[model samples]
Target: MGRHSLPDGSAPASTGSRPGARRRTIAISTGLVLAVAAGSVVALRSDLLPFGEPCDGQSVRLDVAASPDIAPALDAVAKTAREGAARTDGRCLDVKITPRPAHEIADAFGQRPVDPEFQVWIPDSSLWVDRVDAGSGTPLTTAGTIASSPIALGAVPEAAKALGWPKKTYTWTELTEAATTDDALRLGVADPARSATGLLALARINAANAKDTKDGDEADTRTAAAAKLLYQRVADGDGQVLATLPRDDSGAEQGNPRRNQALLLSEQAAYAHNTGEDGGPDLDLFYPQNGTAQLDYPYTLVDDDETTPAQTRAANRFLTLLSEPGGQRALRRHGFRTDNGRPDSEVVDAAGGREPQPYSADPADPPSVKELQALLGMWTVTVQSARITTVVDASASMANPVPDRGGQSRMDLAKNSLLQALATFTPEDEIGLWKFATYLDGNKDHVELSPTNRLGDRDKDGTTHRDALAAAFGSLAPVPGGATGLYDTTLAAYEKACGAYASGKFNALVIVTDGANDDSSGIGLDSLVGKLEKLADPKRPVPLIAIAIGAQADKSALDRIAAPTGGSAHRVDDPSQIHQVILKAIMAAGSKGPR
Candidate 1:
């Protein structure tokens, strides 16, 4: 997926004598003779041999799929192992290293059919391992971590000086704000959807802001603001983002709009750039004072039916070899920290680290899966303009008071939550509103309160579309003697969304209800689901995100109808949680690629 490509051959070598076969043969024979002369007959045993005997049995060959950044170093160690005839259970070990982007491999594993060509996976971070585990894929056994690299902000000398780097230490928030708010320091980042380095850094920033704020909403607002700023200068992936930096040490090139002054990257990446022969300006690294997220390269074993006992043992042996001092030194030479989390001063210095920087400080705790998902959700929404048609239940039961919201009715809380959620969207996003209840409109169960339009669009009165939507949301009230008409309203909204599908935009229908479908005269559940299934198109998807409010809501029915449209159903005990659930659902739907 990047500059690194697979080796000349895609398959592992056959089990046999290797290039140094003659030398191994000589050594093995001499060792046996020496043992015999010493009168230690038992030393001739394969297990007891001081130096392992040449493989009398078949060699155990393993294909290793490693992250691109670490593949070259691993290949070196593997080559050494091959020349030295590394062995497990008297059999020689042969490992072939292939450099692959972790995200591509993760997507492969996420699909059906539990089959993988490689026996071992060494992604740059354990986050990929977690992603695989979260999906329905072949199980992975993580033996241990092999290397580590901390995420940091890297800036050219000129930009670093502007931020008072090397002498002034700033927390994640302070550092990000200082860099992003300045026109002179244009910050760039790899898309969080693609780069762990970017996502982890953003999560760290969120966590740091959360500690300084009073609640989750405030923290989310601050993080979203930062995300919007970053989206303006985002790149697709690590390699592409790095390519955005100035090509030379000239001020003219540095001021180019296409070149980035600063970027979020791993320490090892910075080191590589500084030490490369490209003749570009070296970056000055800043390890946030709040702590940095680390890329813990976990050595995971792919346990599938194709795996053999010998291969398993060989995988374990290779892991042991990687943890040895020789392997650690090799990794350090490649600008990575060993598994013990100790920073190499040489590498740090080469990466532009100085005394005031917290390069050697303990890594920040890894973000939880949920936290990462939420961050991704926010990123997805912030980066892409959405076209959403939201339908809220206007049944009489909505007048029921919420338990702990200072006697606010369910309708009040729901409207307020929707307004709060609306604030998260940008002016480019298109949104509309509908209120539904049986017979709310003449011979219909749903009525559009606001027509879908870009939030920035202005009417004859000079009122923005966003203002109109907000006013409509505020005017929402339960219809007198109205009954739930979930089935009819959902179908109508979904059909409208699909018919007006905004190509290249995140188009979807959001239905929020506090009760089950009560309009029996409308389309049956089976009929509605069938129509949805027929309308669902992979090329023009319109996922129906259904949110059930309170204990009285029918989540099962919502789930059934949602599933056919590549959507999902969620339940919230409190209406105030609708905003969060909506974002999470958007994340989930957006991630289901091509479906």
Candidate 2:
């Protein structure tokens, strides 16, 4: 994601031996000779003299913004450097370490034309660096990583015993299921939107679920279910999630409904809590059999034209000091892995990790930007209620049979996918249905079959809105001799969705079609797109999520139509993938705010 690659798990190489007394004397003699030859009236500063000279009054001060979890350790290292009078290019180093959350710093840097107050940054993961680089802001020069910690599930002693933490090694999927399905476990996680530890852990869980299941729908279902469960007990960040744990070691406190018995946490965090003087219950860590995601504290330089050469050298010098023996010892004492990411047995034992657990396993690959965005989007929609109006094409070609779906028609697969997607929505969400075919509505290309209403609402016949929508989805059939009216249907659906925009809900339009527009008499493509652009309002965004279903579908046209509303278009070769596409599209759009 950036120009600098992550550390390759190798120990830091030696920079070379210090200058000997003879070498220092020769350097001093040489400096005096040069000064005499120059015949200058100005007196030289002490720092310009020799290697062992005392620092002058002008010390280079560098402000460092470090993630809270690692700040104290870095502070200790800074203190040692200050006391030792660490110097770079003959100038004394005065480094100030500030404890700030990684997300807060990332947000600040993500803005345009960032003028960061700090000269250096050490976020919990390189993911934050990627985020800042993705934005239109001042670029960062990554020096390297300082420390690392793998993400794991932390459970109280009682809960750990129940799950057989040390003896039973479970994959991420199995661990998630055990935590979410058992009422006694009371699992919680830091909000993915705020915590890298939380987001990375969730991504690993999703990847594990996908790998274990052959059926895409089943995988999606499992992932969504786990997200919902975690959402119900989500904390604001790593610190907050740990605070949700039982305060005391008593069995009664462990069973408290208001407290969480297990949480998604980093090994360092668990170690801090377990060894803190606060006298709280200790946490036993579970390293997933599948590879663990790690928090690699990357040391990044905030580079700009305003930065002085002295400050740059000072920053690089500080990074070098951090990888040295003294700095490594300090990091280990604070419960962090060294830059190489190799597990230290003492640190692992303190964090409640045991042998046979995959604590030393290689770190999982970092999630891509697209994957992270989609995961956040899904988390947002799953936690928040949505108001979606889905429109389906009922053109004559919809009856075309899928290649490997046991003779099932495209319509059949589409309907089944829609129903599966419907189940993921909460009752608080609002949903509606529409079917479109040329001349099917006696002049209009699309007709509304169900009004957008809360899924929990019931009619006089005691039928829930969810039930009605499901029935409507199942009833969708191809109109005999009908043609695709994609352009007109899209315009009409978007207009209606915009008009009935639900405040504080993920209000949007979803369109599913298997072919390009075949009705030339209907509105033209350019005209439809122009109308949608005119109607689209950023304040009340009703993004148009278009899904093109077969080889005959026009993805390019759909993309143009979707662009105006800040929505996206997706094409799937098999109709059975419509549900996954819809979920991913929803995630992509939802991450862009209300849309």
Candidate 3:
């Protein structure tokens, strides 16, 4: 999950007003200073700082950085620990806890030298630990989890009751469809790529979508549809989603009933949001019937050269303290489960009298690393905006009238379908236009109608690229003497995509054609495939998707051409299905190139 900073951008209150509180206050403030300076955090400065602080030489100071949401609770524990804290072989231990965003610390470790001040780190999810380990190649020593919170669907009582919540079990498919297809229900989520809760929720949705997949493309297509539907309603951040939620009816204004219909959030967040609610329309946690993902707040010790054996022993002592019954109770006050994954009775009573029932979240339900990478790649192109070069066939065959539609030509249907498909893309997504046929642009088989750029962008002439591209689409007239130039045009398009690939965007080439190569001057299929394979680069991938528009379209030839670039080819006989086909193709694109 992305880091949740302190609510007011201020550190937690000092546990006491005595000398110990003052000492801790300085430590917290100093830790924040270091975090600001480093663009990361190593919480709780050691007494050795300032070069002359009075401290017992035998005292072990362990600096611990914790997730923001749980930091304060941990801070409280640290305060109690100070009076008579755990000892390592008769040596006094001073444990300090500071709130830090896990992402920044991970980035710091990957990009810079490690600071010796930080002895232990406790990120919200194991996923963040894995990310740092993968990047740094330095193993982290972890003492299991301190607390856990299951990711759940938070819905207003009205919506939950309407769906038979508590009384009925609902699958992720039903929730996804309701949020995406139903006009009345709005599903809001944070960006899955950034939020663990959102990522897990999406995993459930994907699992439900791909349950009966007979082939990879079918699975990709289904998952894409689900992602696209949910992407539309996402808020900018997790807090925003929580903030929009309706409050309990103490006659208080919670969230917009019209806007905040359902949300994907952690149980801790839900409890914090609806503190006084009891099965009301404002806050009800629904553990999906399909299962869920939990955030296991693992206590990890940094096992690098910077860490000493003394600090390691101190970390072990602290871990033992956190797992004790008293420590578990303190963590439960923050809405996390006990070490064993069961809700604390006090916590259950505090939220309401009803204890949250156990659902089917098998430990392995969370996506594997490979699955996560694929999903993230798909999200980049389909849900998030992308940079795409669209190549359309403008050969004589494109001018043929549709078989059944009144008087609509293949070009007419194709243009309309392409425009409709464009509607699914965000304005931030840059798209360029190209048209192809034999001898269409001097000696070239394809002509660039507009440079690959954002749609709403303007030139010196003040004409918007979107308007210009739409006009270009409207004005296209199939060349009467033209023949399909599939191989040459595809090669040219791929070159253009590569030359203009934006580093941050999902760059791709989308080709829509109604026939196979017929150009005498174009290279043969064998030569084209070999050339494309040689040009393919995983580091700078440019996936090519070929869309065959009719029965006469050559699927085998298109598939063979697309195979070399880790792209895919799809055939759609009906123009109405073009939108769905385009979505599916985009999901599968860029997922299988050089790497």
The clash count for each model shown is 0, 0, 3
Candidate 2 lDDT for residue 422: 92
Per-residue lDDT over 220-304 for candidate 3, one digit per residue giving the tens place of the 0 to 100 score: 6677778777787776556667766554443344344446767888878777766633333446666665666677776766766
Local lDDT at 488 for model 3: 92
Off by over 4 Å in 3: 1-58, 107-117, 134-139, 179-182, 212-219, 247-259, 276-282, 348-364, 390-430, 433-446, 449-595
Query: Please, what are the lDDT tens digits per residue for candidate 1 over residues 1-595?
Result: 1111112111111111122111101112222124335533432343322254455556778999998889989998888787777775576788999999888887788675367889988888777777777775667766557788889999999999988888988899998899899887889998887888888999999999899896887898899899999999999888889889999999899999889999999999998889988777999998999888888787777767778777776775676567566777888888888746778899899988998798888887788767787788777777788999999999999999998789999999999999988988889999999999999998799999999899999999999999999999999999889999999888888888999999878888899999999999999999999999998998898889999998899999999999988889999989999998897798777766441
Residue range with the least summed lDDT across 10 consecutive positions in model 3: 16-25
Cα lDDT listed for each candidate: 0.82, 0.81, 0.68
lDDT assessment of candidate 1: 0.82
The 10 consecutive residues of candidate 2 with the worst lDDT sum are 18-27
**Poorest lDDT segment (10 consecutive residues) of candidate 1:** 8-17
Candidate 3: clashing pairs of residues = 157-281, 246-255, 247-254
Error (Å) of candidate 3 at residue 181 is 4.6
| Candidate 3, RMSD to the unseen true structure | 12.5
Better of 2 and 3 by lDDT: 2
Identify the candidate with maximal TM-score: 1
Please, what are the lDDT tens digits per residue for candidate 2 over residues 229-343?
9998999888898888888878778778989989999999999999998776999999998888888887777766677777776775676567667888999999998747888
